[model samples]
Target: MGAAAYALWGSFPLYFSALAPAGSVEVLVHRVLWSLLLCAVLLAALRGLGDLRALLADRTRTGWLGLAAVTIAANWGVYIYGVQSGNVIEASLGYFVNPLVTVLLGVLLLRERLRPAQWAAVGVGVVAVGVITVDYGRVPWIALVLALTFGSYGLAKNRVGRGTPALVSLTGETLLLAPFALAALVVLEVAGEGTFTSAGPVHTALLVSTGVATTVPLLLFGAAARRVPLTTIGLLQYLTPVLQLLCGVLLLGEEMPPTRWVGFALVWLALVVLTTDTLRAARRRAALARSAVASAHG
Candidate 1:
């Protein structure tokens, strides 16, 4: 299930690319409104309407979900633009950088302390960004924006707390954003710029299917989370970016000059360091728990 979720996520470039002539903004608006519609239907089908109502009744959680909506919308918009503009490789780098960005957010927002290994990993990530920036002859703003918005989205979700079901939280977030998305779509249609009606039946269907495409992987990931360890999920998370990178290079035929290769190598090195530290930490915690249990039994 985890692999399927990431695999779907990684293949998004191909999906978004197929939505051409629609533009990123139009696609994003459709994604938001249609996703909301799908979430509503799923909530009704799964008997989760009560959960959604309870989530909406809470002001604090609602505010966090609203923020999550904004950040994730931004992430989706930037990602769409990147893929449509033939920057799939750069966009893939964003997900590669996202874990590090989350760690940085923890330090800055939550006042968490990082171990030495984590600090080293972050340092390597910074250098990697610098190398990639130089190679691109400008800041990889698309990648940076994608990483930051997603990191912020994660922070908002953390605030909403894990006790909330993923579907319920997504419904709340999309519900908050749906009005704005609807208004934007109306404006686009009025301006005769919307593709939903003008585009052929195939294109129209693909646009609508965006909702299903967005929701399915999320549901799969949620299901996987219920039955997997965090460490396992963490390892599985990399599959998405790795597949995306392959899609960009092999399928899209994006160029990766030597400098860009070096930058990506550094990023992978940092991920290795971070992953090793994470695994070691988890093992240590497990050992300590076992020791405590043994002591109690003895």
Candidate 2:
């Protein structure tokens, strides 16, 4: 399920790329509006309207949801911009570094312990960032911004707990942000800068589908989350970047310099280390469980 979810998410670049001539900001607004509409329908169909009402009733919790909403919307906007502007490869780099950022967040914010291998992976990621900086002759701030913002958004969503279905939470989250998005759409329309009204058939269709394309994977991800462990989810996250990288290099015809390739290689190596460590940990736990069962039988 996680694999399917990530696969869908991995292919998102192609969908968003079709919205040519539409600015990322306009595209993002359409995404929020359409996603909210779709999510509301799903919530109603699933009989989850009561959950959304309850979420709104609690002003305090709703405030936190609002924060999560804003953060995630920002993350989405930045991502769309990255993909639309020939920076899809750099955007892919953000997700590539996200697990390392999550580890750092745990260490700094949650006081979690890290194994030596984890530290080594972090070290390698640092070198990759340095390589990218030198290659660009300046910091790739957009990539870093996307990584840190999305990474932080993930942490916020983690704190949101899991009482409601993902569809409901997503509906509530988007509804919270919809007013702002609507206002922006109105403003852009007034200013003659809106894409929804002016963009041609292909671009307009692509913009509208952003809602479905974005929400479905998230819903799938949420479903998978209910059934999978955090480590498994962590492993699945790489599929998104891998797909985006392929889209950027193959479909978009973006040129990757040797140094950028080297950076990607280092990041990939770090991910391999991290994945190996998690798999080893899972195996050890499985072996211990089997031993316990054998002892009980004896």
Best by TM-score: 1
- Predictions in order: lDDT: 0.94, 0.85
Model 2 steric clash total: 0
Per-residue lDDT tens digits of candidate 1, residues 61-150? 888989999999999999999999999999999999999999999999999999999999999999999999999999999999999999
Assess the local accuracy of residue 96 in candidate 2 as a C-alpha lDDT between 0 and 100.
Answer: 94
The CA lDDT at 3 in model 2 is 92
